[model samples]
Target: MTNALVFLDTETTGLHHDRRPWEIALIRREPNGYTTELRVFVADVDLSSAELMGLNVGHFYDTHPSFRTDSPMRLPAGDEEFQTGPGVWLAVEAKAAVLVERMTRGATIVGNNPTFDVEVLAAMLRRHKLCPAWHYHPIDVVSQALGFLSVLNLRMLGDLLAPELAEDLTPPVKSDKLSKLCGITPPEGDDRHTAIGDARWVQRWYDRLSNPLDGDDETTSVQAQ
Candidate 1:
């Protein structure tokens, strides 16, 4: 089995509040070193209620794959390119069918905030009458990083590793801070809100958390090998 199942992210039309994900990206790593990836934008979204800030942050107007014909992964002329007519509807349905297979094959969804991502994904899938077959329990990278660093809570080691934790930040540090401690630099600029970039960013954090460490590396490494 693959040690790391999947890394995922989405760009939505609303802010942190209830929103709909219009763009999706994910990466699945296999034991044999092959990686499967997908990046797509769902053209159909009800932006009537989308927040102004949400549209700004996600660059909804600027980088939406529909307008960007230069995208390397852009579907052929008749596919996602068609904005109107029967072609567009067929393409959209075809894309949804592909997602049903690809999204569930990995069987797990992992991300910085997986709950929100999965919720949007489920809604998107259901819109096309498809069901989400991913594992019920999604993995949150922030929680995983917290657990990885929880070793510092040990009285003896707390004093030895990251001595400034007691003085600098308060208990229950935020997700961004925790990621920094794990040597993950937050993505910025275009990478900040783009689906594919953010998904890869999540993968970076997952890689850090999965690093070989004392007492844990032996078991995981053996399984991976």
Candidate 2:
């Protein structure tokens, strides 16, 4: 078991491994319920892909290009310093240093699709001749949710085979998306595509799974943090 859980998420220039991450967020939660949040915006990088995706997903406002001298897009929440004359621009080495400072050894990384985030960060680290700071295995919420659904389906079958076991089994229901599992209904004004917003959602999903509510009928009022 780990002493702390680091919920992490990233917003990249694109989906490919070669793409760069312009923004990253991490929320470190200790066993005592204390939490610290860090969000970083890399100063220099291509924002074309990130802009397009964010627009398509309705999270990024369709404003002036981020690279423009008079860009209209608002800086990510809590990242005002990056909104200088041209825009935020952190060198690769500086970004790496911040990541190293936050990601200490023995801390379990948690994310929605953790592998992608890990691979992107690893690529960045390698480019700077640095090694990964966290453990190899990350806690992936998507995979965990899939496993839960699989076991739930299995128990349903078992109960059907033996009625006596029905009392201990939850009724079979179609597996749903992570939003449904955590009862998260993204509010109209909520920031969606940002790294910090997504990381918080993943953390809340993990919490819900850790302490499931009574009477499992595939729906609950457990709101995302």
| The candidate that achieves the highest lDDT relative to the unseen native structure | 1
lDDT of each: 0.65, 0.59
Backbone clashes in model 1, listed as residue pairs: none
All candidates' TM-scores?
0.73, 0.65
Please, what are the lDDT tens digits per residue for candidate 1 over residues 159-185? Answer: 654665433434566766777776777
Candidate 2, number of clashes: 3
Model 2 Cα lDDT, one tens digit per residue, 12-130:
76675466676676777766666766666565555544546643453333312344346544445655234333212323435544554455445789987788888887777777667
Clashes of 1: 0
Q: Which candidate wins on TM-score?
A: 1
